[model samples]
Target: MSLLIIRLLVFVLVFWAGWRLWQYWQGFQNQRVEEQQGKDGHESMVKCEECGLHLPSSEAIQSGKLHFCCSEHRDAYNTPPRDDKDN
Candidate 1:
């Protein structure tokens, strides 16, 4: 009976230790993911040249190596119809 109790205690201790280790590993992984997201979020902001609209860089339109708020503004600035009088 004493040997069986000792074995049970050892098993319980090992199980508890494994559970705690798993929890720590999960926490570490979550922290890593958050850090990566923080870095990406810092790089995400973009400023629009036309209207000065600040937004995510991924959603902005790129033209002539410049970022624009939308396609309409980018197109308007890119190819303005030439006026004969101005020419």
Candidate 2:
């Protein structure tokens, strides 16, 4: 009877350890995902000069030295005759 109790106790301990390990692994994965999201957020944002719109750089139209919220704004700023007179 004592031997059986010892075996049962060992099995329970092993099960508990495994459960704890799984929980830790899940937490670690969640932390990694959060870190990746933070990095992506930092990499994504860009400032638009035309209307001071903050948007993802990937979605913004980029002119020579500025970011625009859309192509229309970029083209408006890119008008050659007006740009030339200003320079």
Candidate with maximal lDDT: 1
Give a tens-digit lDDT track for model 2, residues 1-87.
Answer: 999999999999999999999999999998887676575435467888767889977688888768999987787667664445756
| Alpha-carbon TM-score of each model against the true structure | 0.48, 0.47
Clashes of each: 0, 0
Model 1, 1-87: lDDT tens digits are 999999999999999999999999999998887676575535477788878899877688987679999998887778878889965
Q: After superposition, how far is residue 83 of candidate 1 from its true place, in Å?
A: 17
lDDT of 1: 0.84
Model 1 / residue 70 / CA error / Å: 17
Q: Kindly give the stretch of ten consecutive residues in candidate 2 with the minimal lDDT sum.
A: 78-87
Worst lDDT run of 10 residues, candidate 1, spans 36-45
lDDT, candidate 2, residue 5?
100
